[model samples]
Target: MKRIKNYFTIIAALIFFSGLADAQRSPQRAPQSKAIASSEDQCLFNGTYRIDVTESDRLYSVVEDARSSVPVRDQQQFFRDLSTRLTPPDMLAIECQGTRVTVGSSRAGKITYLADGINRRERLPDGSFVSSKITLGVDSLTFVSSGKAEDNVNVAFESLEDGRRLRVTRRIDAQQLPEPIVIQTLYDKISAAAEWNIYDGDRVAGKMGSAQPGAPPESNRAADALRSEFAIWIEATNRRDIAQQMRFYMDELQAFYLTRNTPKRAVRLEKERIFGSARSVDIRAGEPEIVFQNGGRTAI
Candidate 1:
């Protein structure tokens, strides 16, 4: 009887110790796994989304209805010209992640948007990280955006994603509206996206370096035009004057760039910026690498 009691006592002690060990290890193990999961799970919005052409609509009828108030020209040629320009976007690519949003063609250069109040990490050569927060502002009313944006532009960001909203926004006056008009674009995701954040920095010219290698001579000419334009733009940016930047870009690009860097106040260059100059980023650009198409108007 005494031996049996001792044996039972030893068994109980072994089980208790085993339970305690598991309790301690479980807490440690769960959180490390959770951390890894969270990092991998990420935000669903963090990827490159091209317009699902079959599922996307540009809403040209909204424009036509608003413009219907304009006296319809009876001339057939005028009507034909008007019809040509109103076609829906055949292809649109949008990349959404953290704060950066890119809108344009995959082959062509894209307009980059840095959202309002999101942090981006810059890793130094020494393997230290510093954070810079970016804010995106949009001014839909302006036909011109020289780095600075003004007047009644609608700007807001809602991050809750169930896969039915757009991160970028804009507004304008239309004849059909009693008030200003607003448009929200929606995006869809792709399966493989190891390179979504390609436009991480350098909003002035986005990812032009990716396809510049082995570029033909004619493409070099196109790239030169882009470089010369950027030279003026860089000077304007250095001057801390939005108006100065406008001189280099086309009217469409100026508005798009300014709109993307929204809330106007956040994107300004300080008069006492510490950097004296920026290093020239080497680009091996070719014309085919960047394709821009808007109503049959094409450019590199």
Candidate 2:
């Protein structure tokens, strides 16, 4: 009887210890992930969004009705430009990641909204990483109205991933009606602003006789013409038009050196002269900057 009782006691002790051990070895509960939600997430930087501009049927009709108010040439450009900018069916999904906004139409894989913004990092399927930073601000706004015309109106943004800070502004006419009506008006205003920004930048860079920073001390006409020709030549090459490529240099040589030499010779000589005077020529997205190769190349 004593031995049986002792055996029972030993079994109970072992079972209790085993239960405690199992409890201790169990996995712990993970912390819940947090999400930042806001009423204004539609315009958040890097926030994915779907906007339906076509939902406002009345507004669309109104714009169409007033199309005749604009001049014939202006109307042609306006409709063409607007058609290119806005997606069909009035629905557009945009991912505001970094300085870029990847816009999609009704379905997926139709990315079109590429604007000036900070660079982003993309991970490849093979595990490699690529980073592209947008130089200009992605969330810039310029407002104009009958009474008010302010340039910068920065707004605050909080990063959901890393808690980084971002700023933007809603540039629109202050006297505009309520949100429903103003959304349409604001969309037009903002689109114009973006287009104008790009146009102005390109125009300034493309204008003949425009001075580059740190270029050789040549006359404005010579340097500007050379740059303008170079731009055309590069564009022609990119298009892969052999005739255009030939004509670019031919025209340049005739205009600058007063020579009707072969394309190869003209190109070689032009390159030599340009490089001889250039310490360093920086070809970038913005304005081209040059440094003298020989002496100090002051910007002309």
Candidate 3:
């Protein structure tokens, strides 16, 4: 258990060390959506995800009393002020295994522990205490915490019908804001790294790694299909079939490409020229991953 204690002690260090920002970000690969898991799937969050600050849509509100306090008009400033809580690391990570979950990012580094059994504060070297609790259920993961500077914190993650994205509502209690600030942080679920292993105590295990290939064939087929499609696309980099290739992108993305790149015919000609000059495109895919968006979309 000494090792476990040491590991958690390291986690505390990360929790405190999150203040330091480092330049340069590595590329992230997301798993395709399972897209069709049964409703009884309790382990929907059993993977890692990269979260970003997308334009807020339908999310929880922060204006505690819209009538009493003036609404925050300057969205950029508001988001900037709440950057620490909203987006510090361009890409955020959430790892959930069984009932335990860890949320990691640039600013808050990382925090990992049992979901239902954690309720304590870790005193940092700076003589300040960071306290938090995690409560996991069938459909939601609730994290409640507060620090020396914070009055109260509530960040809730709700699982949609599909598992591609989670609706996050964060409420930070700081005296700096006009009132309690509520921010909507929607996290698009992505696939974890292939060859990445999850260590449970001393028992070593491989997840989405080569060693565990086809361990759960049914669940992995969708992810595999996505990979296969990508491989095919790579091989066909010099492909002239615009119709077939256009199918590679989502409608929203296709529309964006058409608009941003110019006329459809011109875009096709550009692709042809680019691919025609390429010698070969290499496919460097790792283990397969899966994510199911609520609207029946799959992203890999």
Candidate 4:
């Protein structure tokens, strides 16, 4: 009987030790999952992007308004120049690692900030100091910088279009100005393997191929045909030819008009009404930028 009791005790001890070992190993797996979550969260904003010049130019009115507030004097000319040439960097490279975020560009060099909501100070070339802070949110990242003269700048990067685009809003506040200068710009994420074709009114102006193997010849031909079709559509819209414009869209098409979706027939009727009422239509369309996706089956 004593031998039997000893065997049971040994088995109970083994089970307890095995559970303790599992408990220690479970915490190790938790940290790895956490790290994976962090990486996935950062992936949304981590990539190279190019500024959408056409979209950015649409917001130039805000810059013009701000420029009017400054005088022609040298001290104030700086403000004017800033407003006039407030062009965003042509290219932006973003990197996110743990609590650190880095934004780099040819114009702005490189800047690193901690997303811990703590203000960091750095001296400018003129020996003046500025305080800057960065905050990371669920879907946006905000950065604010202020100087001793009560002049401050705030920049926010928002992820839009399911992380395919970024909208950057900048606000400049100065003590001498009555209102802050606000400029908003859009950026399109550049895929590493993207193939771009530039169109100039139904003519292929240029083609940019990725470093990887080029798409099949058939695929390229199909893409070129689509590009040409798009250019012709734009030409039709510019000339206010409702019939030609309607040819590009399918009968069952649903077009997004401002805030709501309208069927193709309604779209045609609306276009007819507008074209009929207007004395003259002089629509100038910018160069179309096309990004091919789904193995050249879709373009956006």
Candidate 5:
């Protein structure tokens, strides 16, 4: 009877300790998750980005408005600004594993989420913030009052079919990264001396106009073909092959080269052949003419 009582007592103590340990661990896990997850207020980034509609092209304007608020003059500038957004500082999220944020059609308009990071913010009619940036794992994808925090709020979908429109909100604080470890390891390759491993060879290969053999250059195959053709053209020109040169140039360029008049040469006189005063030689632009003292005394 005493043994049974002792066993029950022991089991109760184990349960009590496990519960206490769980309570201690739960708080730690919450902060770690919160660190990656931003609040609605924290995620709320608001600023006026300009978009230029030159000739009121709906297709172009729609595409421009769907991606970003940054002002763009033409399609070229549009690509440039979008490239910037895809990079650092301006972007809200990096590659979040198991966390995806997308803008597309759904039953309740377009919805964006942090998936499992931070609670999202509510969007107002004027695109004002109702709360903080959505934390990850907060599966709240509703715009009930236009007052609660939302991930995708005030977003104007350019077209439901193409989804080309752009609406850039404030960039999230992804710039805040944890301190890098100084210790050398296989995983910390980019931060350590390993960055130089491929970079040094790449630099050399670029200067020499070839790849390092082990790794292919990032440029397309078309560029390599063009470079090879240029080399062959240079070689043919150095050899002075009329047939090869004719093959290298097009019809108009070949005619232009052949018809251009060659300049005539002047009389040759040695430095010692002339005597008396020196005279300046005036020559026109694009003409090659040399003048120097012919005699030991001076050339006239």
Candidate 6:
């Protein structure tokens, strides 16, 4: 009886130790909490977006609306300052991580926000300062700015079309203004492969492709005019005429040169420095090829 009892005790100890080793080797995983899942859901706007010019309000109209309220004496100065503040960026890059969101704009630089409902003072590009707060919602992200004299601006961004498009709405209000200025803009999310379609009347006409279609008579004439203009510009460049080169661009022009989006003044300064430093310059430009787009109302 004693021998049998000893044999049973050894077997029981072996079984208990084996179970302990197995538990250490394969531990159970804790279920994910709801907070982590909600945090991930807030990243719907995480992508690069390009402004859709056709669907966005023109800057001229917005300026005109604001100009109506200002006095004639102050209109000129107010417009100068307002134009810089109201112009929308051409591209925006958005990043969402946890409760932090960062927005990078082509024109306005970059800004980071913590969506904790705390107001922070930030300086604008025009050197003016405003207190702003950013908040994240279920389906939209909002930014509100407050300035002096009851001046307030609200900007909201909402995802659309299954996150392929974004709608941005901006509202400006001030004590001097009788009515609020509201603007809505649309942006398209960029993807690895994208296609821009140009419509002609009721048909899809110019899809971006490698093959160049035969030019119409009107297109040929426009191409000739562009070539002539290009030749003149090239001549001016070789002669190092900064003023002549500058005449080719408009005041509101934004040129992408050397991988940077440079304004007209900066472009002029750069050209001036290059023209002044170089002793002899030889420039050769080929004939310009014009592609009629937007039903021939625009050309590229």
Q: Write the candidate numbers in order of decreasing TM-score.
A: 6, 4, 3, 1, 2, 5
lDDT of 6 by residue, 1-300 (tens): 332233223222221111112112222333333322146455677776667778998765675656345567555445444444566655566767665566655443345556544556655444665566566654577777665533366778898887788888877665545777677889888642222111111111232232235535665566567767889899998988888889888665543322234578887887887678888999784333344556678764
Q: Give candidates' CA RMSD values in order.
A: 23.6, 28.9, 15.1, 23.2, 29.2, 22.7
Give per-model TM-scores: 0.30, 0.20, 0.40, 0.48, 0.18, 0.51
Q: Estimate, for each residue in 1-300, the C-alpha lDDT of model 2 and write its tens digit.
A: 332233223222221111112212223332222221221333344322222232333333332333233345455444333222222212222344432333332222333222332233444234543332222132331111111111111112222223122222221211111111111311111120112122122223223122234333354455466567778766654554445656644333432222233356666555556456666554434344221222323321
Local distance difference test, each candidate:
0.34, 0.31, 0.46, 0.54, 0.25, 0.56
* Candidate 3 structure quality by residue, lDDT tens digits, 1-300: 332233234333333323211200112222223322223235565444444444443221333222222144543333323342343222345556565455654234455555553455656565766676656666677766666443356667776656666666766554334465566656555554311222121111113344234445544565557667876765555454556676665433333221432455665666677567778655454333333333224342
Q: Give the per-residue lDDT of model 5 (tens digit) for 5-56.
A: 3322322222111111211221122334533324432221111111222212
**Better candidate number, 1 or 5, judged by lDDT:** 1
Worst 10 residues of 3 by lDDT: 194-203
Worst lDDT run of 10 residues, candidate 2, spans: 144-153
- Off-target runs (Cα >4 Å) in candidate 2 are 1-60, 67-90, 112-300
Find the 10 residues in a row with the least total lDDT in model 5: 180-189
Per residue, candidate 1 scores C-alpha lDDT tens digits across 51-132 of: 3333333334333333323234322222233323223222234444433444443333455544333334444334443333
Cα displacement (angstroms), candidate 4, residue 219, comes to 20
| TM-score, structure 1 vs. true | 0.30
Candidate 3, backbone clash total: 7
lDDT per residue as tens, model 4, 125-150 = 45666666566654577777666433
